[model samples]
Structures are given as structure tokens and as C-alpha cells.
Target: MTAETCENGPLRRFLTVSNKLAALGAIGVSIGFVIVIWVQNNHTRSLLYETELQDSIRMTEVIAAQLYGPLRWRKPSIAQDTYDSMITHRDLHVVAAVTLDRQGNVVTTYQQNSSQPFNFQELRLNAGADLRLDSTWTAELDGKLVVATPVTSHDGRKPAGTFVVAWSLAEIDRAMRAMFLRAAFITIVLFAAFTTLSLAIVHRQLSDPLTQLTQATTRIANGDKTFEIPCTDRRDEVGDMARALVTFRENVALIDRLTAEQQQQTLRLSNALEKEREYNALHREFVSMVSHEFRTPVAIIDGAAQRIERRVGKDTEDQLRERTGKIRSAVVRMIELIDSTLSVSRMEAGTIELEAAECDFAALLREVCQRQQEIAKHHKIDLTIADLPSRILIDAKRMDQVLTNLLSNAVKYAPDAPDIAVKAGTVGRNVVVSVRDRGLGIPEAEMPKLFEKFFRASTSAGIPGTGIGLHLVKHLVELHDGNITVDSTEGKGSTFSVTIPTRYGEADAAASAALSA
Candidate 1:
């Protein structure tokens, strides 16, 4: 569709055809009626003006006849009295009159209400030597018509004088204006009545049925299959439209039902595909974990045993003991890996339970610090303990696992760094533990996924890890109803902080009070 079609509203879309037909017919009728009235009015006005002109000339001739005898005797008083009497009859529209001798010089002038003394130079006389008796000429001056008639002698042989009379056409103009107004009023009333009647008929015959069809079409567009089209019974184009709409509705409903079933199938397929992908990923992770983590310890133990067997007779007793010690250490390392994996499984199965007890928070942190220092012989583990609460409710075994993972990560990731700092303090009603290492710091982009399972930072790529240490630590901390946060800058250092509530709930409150006391 074009831009104009898109911009069309409901009235343009639905009512356009019927409305246009009604409007065109009304406008055509109105224009024709106005034209007819205007032409008739103009014709009537022209005829009325002609009649008025003839009447003025006739009146002038009659007055001139009355003045013929008076002008022959040069009696100005009798002509003046006649003019005064005519002006007094207001409907005559007479304004002034003048009498002139045969030489065209004014003999006398008479004016009604006001005087404009006659100027002989202004008189335009067209009388000829062969001018007929009772001959008349007319001219217009301002808004008045001036009629000039010749006064002849009783014998009809000689022109006696000229009689001029001025008649106003204002009355004629007023009558014409009234006639025009009446015609205009009648035309407007008839136009409005006929236009309204035509629109009403058009609305009933065309617009209404079309509107119902449009509504049904809209319902179908909106996915409503239940709305019935009522016009299908009539044998017309609208009925044809209604029947088509019913068919369209049925098709749409069928499509909707098929679409719903297809959607259900699609959802089932998606879920099954996702589950298969997850299973494949878990299998890969299990294989990688076992191969990478177990291979090193197994090889180390095997090599140590082989060396001990080789030194059976040639080496000193100390050498055999040292080789055996190496084998035992490798075995212990493998056992720890197995334990961590088992702990993960138990945690996932929701079978690992916490044994809550009151423990010395600072002492626990110090002991973990000493243990990390021994394990990381090359790196110093510093302890920075503030005045922590004397006791707090905790699951000691789980917390030890949490601290060990964090410290081990520090030593593993920051092997070349000089020291790791383990900090403990009380902030509000919570105990805070932090492990900081001055090593190759984590990248900013890697920080968000630091606690995610099987995810390792790019900086830790060369480091030996199953990638579950921090992930396990996070779960342990959260299981104790705590939160953990990390702050790190690239090439500087990284600090992981854990905050644990001092008391679990009201059950721990009495124990906490006794511990504080």
C-alpha cells in the first residue's frame, strides 16, 4: 500500500464509498439549484428595471403635458406647484425637476427637501430640429434616473420647452434585494433537506451493511474465530463478503489449532535437545577432570615406587624412606582430589549437612594461615586479625574447606609472588574473612565468571586446577548464609572477601550471648 493508503483512518477505510456517493449527489443538487435561482433572479431583475424605466418615462411625459400650457405662458409658479405636489407623494421617488425654454436655457427649477440650483452648462440637450412631439430621453445621474421630455404647444407644431424630472431607483433596488434573499433561503432549505434525506438512505442501504462486514473482518484479523457474520443470508455483494468471511474464519481457526500443536512439538524438541547437550557437556567435563587431575599423581606415585624398587640394594636406607615418603604424598594428593569430587557430588545431591557449633573465628583463620604457609613453602602467608568476636556459630568443617580452597588458589595462582595475606575481622554483626595475593592479577573481564564451575581465568591457564575450587568455595560460603565479593586489578593483585553472619537465627542467639559473655 502507498503512504496515503496507510494513513487512511476507519472512516476512509469503511465509509468512503457510501459517503462519497451521498456527498457528490448533494453537492450536484445544491449547485444546480443555486444556479437556477441565480439565473431566474437576474432575469426577473432585468425585466423589473426595464418596467421601472418605462414607468419613469411615462410619468415624465404626463408631467410635461401638464406643463405645456404653463411653459407657453411662462408661468413658473404653476409648474413649481406641480413639482412640489409630485415630490410630496413619496413612492414616486421624485427628487427634482427643471423647465427649459426652446433655446435650452433653464426657465425654472424645483427641488424637493434640498436645492441644487440648476446649471445651464451642465444640461446635455439632445433635442433635434425634427424632434417628434412627446419625444423623451433618459440619463442616470448618481443614483437617480433623469428623464427629459419636450413640452409642445397645443397645436403640436412647435417645441415649447424641455421638462426634466429626476426619479430615484433605491426602491427598485430594495425590492430586488428582498426577492434575492427569499430565493436564497428557499434554496438552502431544500438543499439541506434533500442532502440529509439522501445521506440517511445511503447509510441504511450501503454504509450499515459494509460496516458490519468490516467489523467481522477486523475480528478475524484479531484471531477471533467465534464471531458470526450475520449478513450471509442476503443475496447481495455484502452477503457474498459475509460468506467469504465465514470461510476465512474457519481457515484461520484451523491454522491456529495447527500452530498451537506445532508450538508444543517445537517446545518438546527444544527441551530434549537442551538436555542432551547438557549430558554431553557433563560427560566431557568428567572425562577431562579424571584424565588431567588423576594422571599427574598416578605418574608421580608410580615413578616413586619404581625408584624405591631400583634402590633396593644399592641405595642407603634413608633413600628408600625418602622415595616411599614421595609415594605417600602423591597418594594423599590423589585422595584429596577424590574427596573434593565426592564433596561436590554430595553437595549437589543435597546430602551434605552442616554441623553448626560455636567456634573461635580468629583462631580458625590463624590456623588456616599457618597450614597454607607450610603447604606453600616458598610463599609467606601473613595473618592480619582484628579484634573479632570471641565466638560465632559456624559449621567448622565446611569453613575449613572454604578457607583451604581460597588459600590454595592464592598459592597456586600467585606462585612467584612473595606473600599471601589472610585477614579476619568483625564488621557489624558479620565475620569477614579475606585472602589477598600479590600475583598476576585477574583480568577485569574474567572476574564475573570467577566462581562459575569449570571456568578458569586466562591468567590461570598454566596453573593446575580442576576449576571447581572457587566454585565450591562460593557454594560453601552461601550455604552458611554468607556473601562473597572480590576486588582485583590487572598486574597488581586480587582479594577475595567472604562475609558470614554471626548468628544463624534465634536458635543461635542464646548460644551467641553465652559465647560473648
Candidate 2:
């Protein structure tokens, strides 16, 4: 090292590591002492000034009383004598007495050692006849206190003139200056002594504990978790830090065990992710196979039912025709199930599209209600559909499927419910379709996850469902820029509402016959 570097090395180390507690303590105490001294001095000065001002006001009152008898009787000599006597006080600067007549004109004036020219007329005008018996002082008048008092009769009935006094504050200011200097000197001496004592006490109390803590921390940083700070018996902040360091060392030892467990958990999570991927692949394959395999059989059964119905003669037995109708209805239900599964698959793949066209929402709902009544022969379907304007636009096929799923769910869940109500109406710019059933209502907790794929309510235990119906309904409705909401009470009933936008730009004509037909 060079000469300059050698000289600066110790200073550099000290600057980097020295605690500076002594210097900081000295500065804080000094500032606090100065502030206390300043506040006390200001308070003392205010009290002294107020006392002097009050004394001046009292002197004016005494002088005014003496002059009152002379001025009322129009005795100028007695009044002038009182004014001269009052102005002889050491601090008194000017004293003036003036008498005014009924017309407010000055009749007599006496002033001794006057500081400024006095206009009796102006003074009387400003201090009106009804002025209260209180003294007024202005601080901005060059450290002088000014008082205005009314000169009246012995009974204090009629005011003759005004008495004004001006008192100098030079002596008061000089005394305050001396007092402040003495207070400042004493405060400085006390601050120095207290700061030195505080520094010594702080060093005695804190330096050894802090030094031990630093050594313990250094050992911990160098991977010695067994090291302990030697100041745990202290009750102050240093002891608190020492205890915290002990806990930190304990935590450092525990971290190695946690790291090993974390590696095990990570390995387990990786295995679980692989199993989830396998399960998803299997689920997809099952859905695809069900859709492909069920469609052909359902089509074959439906075609056979149709052919039998067409060829049936009037002589055919009612029982045979009923069986054929049942067969066709069962096939239709199976087809609907397969189609719902396929729709969910398409939605997941993001390939489903809505074919928007002007549609009569009321007519479409009436048709869906009729079909549901036929399919659910044991239940009653009450349709309260309103005639919506033809300007509403939607995809007819998707909308039909949406209604079908809701009606099917209602029939399946409320098998013993005597009647289900299907209502359609126009609300603002949207067409709403509601299906309600007085059956086992869904629990409130299940409503949030009601539209999630493959999520069935606890009440749906033993009810046959693929759990894709409501999810599909939600997706199809949203595809047409619509929303669905469900309101259910635990043992009363449940209502599912679907809102679809009415895209009619003022078109109100029917595109087909009534759906009931």
C-alpha cells in the first residue's frame, strides 16, 4: 500500500463499521435542549409583555378617573394637572386628554410629551359615543402599547372626551434579552453534561452486548448454527435481538430438513400430473366412442319406428301403436343425450359456431314445451310464452337444444312434481326463457359450480345424468351472447333463466306459424 492508503485504512474501517451512537445521542440531546429553551423563553416573554400592557392600561384608567371630575365640570387646570402627573412614569411615553361637546367638537385639549399629533374630532369619530369600556392596544406601534379610554361624568352617564396613553416597551425588551441569554447559557451547559453522561451510560449498557451479538452473527453467517449470543438475560432491545438471532439459527438448521421434504413433494406432484394427463386422454376417448357408437343405433331405432307408423293400418291395435310411439320417444331421448355430449366436445375444442338469424323466441319455446310434455308423459308442462317481436336474432338449433336440456333436467329431477312451468317473455333488449319445477331444489352451495362440466349436486345422487347438460346449455347460450342464471330454494323449487339478445333492428313479422300448432 502507498503512504496515503496506509494512513486512510484505519479511518476507512472506522467509518464503515463504527456505531456512531455517542455522536448521535449528543446531537439529539442538544437539539432537544435548544428547543426546550426556545419555547420557555418565548413563553416567559409573552407573560412579561402581557403584564406590562395590563399595567399600562390600569395607569390610564387611574389618570382618566382623576381627570374625569375636572373635565366634567369644565376645569382645565385640574385635568391638565392629572395628565402631567400620569406622563411622568418611567415607561410612559405620551398621555393626552381632550374634552368634546355635544356636537363632537373639541372644547379643551391637554397633551404631555406626545408621540404623534392628535385630532380630537377624528379620535371621537373613531371611538364613537357607544364605545365599550375596554382598552385597545396595537403591537405594530413600535413596541408601544396604546390605550383609549372614555372620559365621562362621576355617575358614568355622559362622555365628555377620550383619554389615550402610549407606553414604551424598551425596558421590557432589554430584560427579556438578558433573561433569554442566561437561559441559553444554562441550557447549553446542561445539554453538554447530560449528553456526556448519556453516552457513557449507553456505552456501558449496549456496547458489550452488541459486540457479542455481532460475533455470534458472524459465526452464524460462517455456518456455525450452534453459536449463541451472550446477552439473552437483558430485557432491553439488545436482548430481544439476541433471542431473535437464536430463533434464526434454529430456522437455519430446520431449512435443510424442509429442503429434502420439498424435493419429495415435487417428485410426488410430477407423478400426479402424469396420471392426470392419462385420465384426461381416457375421458376424451370415452366421449368420442359414445358419440360415434350411440348415434347409429338411435338412428336405426328411430327409422324403424317411423316406418312402422307410416305402414300401420286403421285396423292396427292401439297397444302396437303405443309401443311404437314409446320406441321413437326413447330413441329421441338417446339422440339428445349423444348430441349434448358432442356439443360439449365441440365447445371444448372451440369449434362450435352460432348461425344468427331472426327467430320468433315465443314460438320456439311453445314448441319446446310441447315436445317436453310429450316426452315426459307422467308430468304436466304449463307454457306461458309471450309473443316476442320477430326482430330477435339467434341460432334456432342451438336455442332448441338449450331449452331441451333444461326441460329434460326438470323432468328427471322432479319426477313426482305434478307440473313444470315454462315461461318466455321479452325483458328490455333481451328475450328470457325460464323453466321452473316444484321439486328437490339444489343446495345453495352447489349453485356456484352448477355449470361446471361433470359437476352434479349432492341432491342428484341416484339421478341418471352425464352432468354435461347444464354446462352445454351455458356454453350454447354464451355462444349467442347470452347468459343463464339459476335460483333455487332447498325444498321449494328451482328456476333456470336464459337471456338471449333480440337482434331485430325493428323487424316485427312472423317467419313461421305458431309453435303450439
Candidate 3:
């Protein structure tokens, strides 16, 4: 079949590919042009409105100045003459002008069209109850611009009366309408020319060659591999596509071989993923068993100590009482360690979340210090709290855990140090709580890995720790949309500071609510 007959056979019943592309291009260009024109029209109208408003105000000021003497001396005849002279100017387009005395009684008035009714009472109400003669006031009402200027005495200290003028806005409206019509006509002409040119170029450069390529591709799709693709010599994208098709036919066997190998690789990956999933299941089971196994004995030890203390009361030796107290303390410490381990596991499994609420932060800090002091009798914890908010939004239980951990670390790491300083205050829009201790400070080289999981500083060699306290601390702080930082000097001391915002943002609050739900 001839090329023209082939193009018209079935494709012409619908829009051809080239025709559709040209039409889409025309639509996009028209939308962009219309948007630009709309913005320009609005900007031009604003400029014109502002220009006319200023000119009206200036003209009213001049009329008020001329009428100052006439109203001051109570010469109604002269005031009428001044008002008439001002309104007679053709460019002013004054619809009605009125001069009123200090008590708002009309002294003299001028109306360009005597047929229209002018309400003096409405004008007085618009001027305001105070008369406000010290400055000018302007308003637009019923397609008219009204300006009221003060006519002051010769000394400019007291006002004698007010000069009010109303101008018609019809001229401005007419000008804007004319501008819109002209722009619409130009847009129509340009759009027609652009569409015609785009169609011509698309049909010449794209439609004919793509038609031949389409026929060749159809033949290959039907298993006619001996058919040749045309447009191979054009030195453009079309020629590249034609050459790529030839290579595709030759590599059919290679592609089939690679696909089979890929299937084998996918099967191997699936088996590895299954093995990893099984390992994770076993890990979770182990954590659950450890939690139940460790808590039972600790609870028994704590209960036995309490029973012995109650039985051996007045006749008990001081040493015996102290020994029982140590047993209970040890039980508490073990429980804390178990909880921390579970917390880390939950975090890794992505099941940990915050239960944020309004908390009394100051009371919470004082309680933490008191509990830490009870455990570490040798080291005194000195708390210095500044003016803090009455209530702060935070996860109170998790925050209590954070403070206890910090205090415990301070007492454990600082063997010889006698005191720990705890401070809480507000900085900018955040709340900052810092715990400082006089201990063997961290090595500077290991500072970068301080918050990494299972990382321990060299200075913590002799100290009893699982090396996950700071890492867990950092993670918990970040969950509250906060951060923890440290400052230390070797052989001196270390200060760990936590900073968090006073409240969560709307998006965070919504997410928290959804998670809770």
C-alpha cells in the first residue's frame, strides 16, 4: 500500500500521534498565555485604581484649603463659589461636593447632576461621630469615591469645618473594559497562528517517518523477523531507534538465557530472606523468655527481705537491717537492667512509641534526684532548677527512666567524686536538662561513637555498664523530637544535656494520636 493510503486507513479515524501531540502543545501554550495575561491585567488595574485615588485625594485637599477662609468667617456665599469653581473642572468628575460646619451642618453644597438625590445625613454618618478634623478619611460607596478633608483655621491648630467630595468611577471602569477586549482579540489571533504552525512542523518532521517505523514494528511483533526497519540513515533519534530494533532481533536468544538465570538468582534470594525471618522470630522469643525468667527471682528476693525487716523490729542489729536494705536495692537494680534490655529490643523491632502528656517537669526532676541520692549515699546530688513552665508536654514515664539512667551513670562512673550537679531550665523555645559529674571524662577520640549502639568509651573500662545506656537515651530523646549532647574533658568531668521542644507540632500530634488509636 502507498504511504498516504496507509496513514489514512485506520489511524485517521482517530487523531494520529503527531496530531495529538501538536494539540496538547497548543493547549499548554494557550493556558500559560492566558495566565500571564490575567496577572498583567490585575496589576494594571491596581495601578490605575491607586493613581485615580491619589488624584482624588489631592483635589479634595486643594478644595478644602480654598474653602478654609470662607467657612472660618461664616461667608456661605463665598464658600458656595469656591465649591462651584472646584467641581466645574472637567477632569475632576465631581458628582457632589458639600462643605459642613464643625457641628456637621451643611454650610454650602454643589452637585454636578442636580437630578440625583444627595442625602446629607448619610454623608455625615460616613464622616464618623467624632468629625475627626485632624486628618482626612476616604471611602468607596455605591460606585463613588468619597473623600473628607479637614478645613482648619489660619493657625492650623483647630478645625473650622469639613470639605467632602464624591467622584464617579465610571471613567475608570470604561478604560479597564477597553483594555480587556483588546487583549482578548490579540490572544485569539496569536493562538490560531501558533496552532497552524505547530501542526505543519509536526506532520513534516515526525508523522511520516514514524508511520513507516510503526509498520516495521508491527511486522516484527507478528513474527515477520525478515522485514527491515526503514529510516536507518537519517542521523537522528529515529535512525537510532531503527538500528536498536535490528540489534533487539539478533539478541532474542541472549535475553531468554539471562531471564532464566535471573529466575534462579531470585529463588536463592527468597530462601535467604526466609532464613533471616526465622532468625528474627527466635530472637524475639528469647527476649520474652529472659524477661519472665529474670523478674521472678528478683521479686522473691525483694519480698523476702521486706518480710524479715518486719519480723526483726526493735531487737534487730543495725548491720542486719543494712544488709536487708542492700538486698532490696540490688533487686531494684536488676529490674532496671532487665527493663533497659527490653526497651532496646522493642526499639529495634520498631514497636516503641511515646505516650506524651502534660507533665510537671520540676516535680519530676526533684523526685529523680531524691531516688538517686537514696541509692548512692556517698555522692550528694545538688539540683538547681530555674523558672520553668508550669506544665510541659512529654512522655513522663519515659522521661523518668531517662533521668534515672543519667543519675545512675554519674554515680557509678565517678567513684571518687562526692557530688553530682543537676540543672533544669528553659533555653529559647526548648527545655534543657543537664547532669554534670566530676568523674573520669570520656576519651576525645571516642566522642563520635558515643551514641552508637553497644559502644563504650575507653574510660568506662572498669565501670559496670552494658554500653547501651547512652544509645538508648539518644533514641528515646529523638522520639520526643529532642536531642542529647555531651561535653567532656579527659580526667575532669562530663555533662550530658537533653534538649526538647516545649510542645509537639500539629503534624506530630496527629501522628501520635493515630499511633495511639
Please name the candidate that would achieve the greatest lDDT relative to the true structure: 3
Tens-digit lDDT track for model 1 on 23-92?
7888899899999988998898889888988999988887888788778898888877777665565447
* Per-residue lDDT of candidate 2, residues 118-158 (tens digit): 65554555445555556555554445566667666667787
Question: Would you list the C-alpha lDDT of every candidate in the order shown?
Answer: 0.78, 0.74, 0.80
Clashes per candidate, residues 3 or more apart or on different chains:
0, 1, 0
Worst 10 residues of 2 by lDDT: 504-513
Q: Of the candidates shown, which would achieve the greatest TM-score relative to the real structure?
A: 1
| Regions of model 1 farther than 4 Å from truth | 1-199, 208-212, 215-279, 313-325, 360-363, 388-391, 504-517
Ranking by TM-score: 1, 2, 3
User: How do all models score by TM-score?
Assistant: 0.53, 0.44, 0.42
- Please state every model's RMSD to the true fold in angstroms: 13.5, 31.0, 42.1
lDDT of 3 by residue, 189-295 (tens): 77777777788888767887787777776666555667667878878888888888778766754665688899989999999999788756645654554565466
Residue pairs with clashing backbones, model 2: 391-504
Better of 1 and 3 by TM-score: 1
lDDT of 1 at 40: 91
